[model samples]
Target: MSTLQQLLREIDAKQKRINKQRPLEQTKIKNLKDYFKVGLTYASNALEGSSLTEIETKVVLEDGIAVGGKSLKDHLDAIGHGRAFDWMWELAKGVAISEEDVKKMHVLCFQPSEGEQAGEYRHVNVVITGSQHNDRLPSHEEVPALMNAWAVGLPEKRKNRHPVQYAAQLHQEFIVIHPFADGNGRVARLLLNHALISQGYPPVIISPVFKHEYIQALEQSHTKPENFTAYIAEQALQAQRDYIRLLRIE
Candidate 1:
């Protein structure tokens, strides 16, 4: 069997196991939610070159204490991302995604650093430093319509595809649009997680250690989109395994 097929099978098996335990204990839900708040904040920021460690991220979010030797922006990124992640959960209680949902997450994520432009699409074009294939982002003029279309089409997209594929499509398409002037990657990840969590899948954390591979997959998305889709499935399978461990599921 192909690797992607194997990963999807494993994911399906674990998801079935998890489904049998629906409505997990409140304590387990609370603990896992808190754990991922820090983990998602740290990893998402780290992928964008922030220097905060996972412990430091927790301290900033839980204790509001700033670590010395780290720039203020690092603390802001961590805290802001935590706020955004929380809002993602807020939206998870519902079934629809909207342009406002995407914009609001971006605003919360970047409000500390660039409040004025927080949720606003860029009026000026920009380039992603060091990127080659994935940098051919949509023109600034196209963002509004593209975003509207994406949000409008999601119900259909989710209806016909597997949850992992839907999330990957959601992630890849958002990155290609590059809607916001900054912090797009973090928000894209947030939306991806939102899509997964709403479908009862564990949130995928694209660790910084695999940032290169992740980016390469995204870059190749311009051509062989299946490669990127399969890469995302692999991440989802890993998350499923970890989630099962947390629940101590037999």
Candidate 2:
């Protein structure tokens, strides 16, 4: 078997153990959810240049207080992304993922800063700064049609893939679409976790420390998508380990 296939098998084994503990997750995972809200909020924003430390993010999100000297947008991102993640947690329990779900997540994460443009698709072309092939992104005019087709075909695309691969594909594709004006990365990560969480897998938290490697994988995705997919599987493996640790699954 390929190494990723082997890793996936191990992930499946861990997931089975976690599934056995699912009844207690309603309580046990509740606390972990709050913990991950802070962790995910910190990592996702930091990857995008937010200045809030993890402690600062937790302070802004849970304590309802702003950090001493952070930018207003920084504080807002923590608060807003946390709320969107909350909604995504609820959404994961549902039967399907819809395009509206994607837009709503963008709105929740960006409305505090982006206003009416929150859920709206971009009207002008965007350039993915630092990417080698920015032209690979669809034009703003193409987003609506592309996203519609994507959401419509999601069920079929998800059918044969392993959950981790599906989640990674979801993340990669959403990032490529670059649907909304801002917050695409955050929303894309939300979509990734939504797929994973709904399937009894843990959310993959890409730490800021891995920022360079992560962006490189994403940028290279245009040519070698499996490289990115494998990168995501590695992240999923770590997330699965952390999740099992929190669940005390020995």
Candidate 3:
């Protein structure tokens, strides 16, 4: 069987357990596994294809590097804190971000440059997987169109589907488009949590701890079109586990 399909089956099985263990996630392995998945996904998105050894070193130092000096662990911690903060704040208000707000939020997140002050909002094209080779941007004009499709067709039924699924889809689509000069991953992650927070699920944290697996999933999606969905679904399942783990459940 294809890896993606295998992952799907695994996700469905895990989902059944997660639903049953809801509210009491900390007591069960099933719940812990799901939360672990969340930490992995956030780490994956933040530090895709990064090295763990380097991540640990920088993590110990607690220093934020502009572009390269930062390690995988640093990315994980940064994203985790950001997601948690947003999740808690949004939860208290009983509110969700609008599409307009998504764009503005992304702009704000991408504003800070290494040498510049915070809040610089990028207006240039972003290229992933090596900007030199994949320098093409997914037309800025098409961003809203694509986002609209994602917003409308996201997985998980309007009322029944886990909010994480929507957040995952939004993140994948945003990264695929490479919409900004910087902070695309961070923006995608923020949008991802917005969906989850709105739905009342704890924010998903993708840890740099699983950087390798995360990149492999994205690489599979980019190289094999038929497998992208499966890849994404699998990634989401893993992310669920990370979230549970962070909460110290199980």
| Each prediction's TM-score versus the true structure | 0.96, 0.97, 0.55
Q: After superposition, how far is residue 216 of candidate 3 from its true place, in Å?
A: 4.0
Better of 2 and 3 by TM-score: 2
RMSD of each predicted structure: 1.3, 1.2, 6.9
Give the alpha carbon lDDT tens digit for every residue of 1-250 in model 1.
9877887888999999999988888887878789988999999999999999999999999999999999999988998899999999879877578999888998899886897999999887878776775457888998899899989999999999889999999999998888888888999999999999988898998899999999999888877788999999999999999988988888
Per residue, candidate 2 scores C-alpha lDDT tens digits across 191-215 of: 9999988888888899999999999
- Over 4 Å off in model 2, which ranges? none
How does model 3 score by TM-score?
Answer: 0.55
lDDT by residue for model 3 (138-191), tens: 665666566666555553343554344445556666667765555566666666
Total clashing pairs for each candidate: 0, 0, 32
Which has the better TM-score: candidate 1, or candidate 3? 1
lDDT of 1: 0.90
lDDT of 3: 0.51
Candidate 2, residue 102: the lDDT equals 89
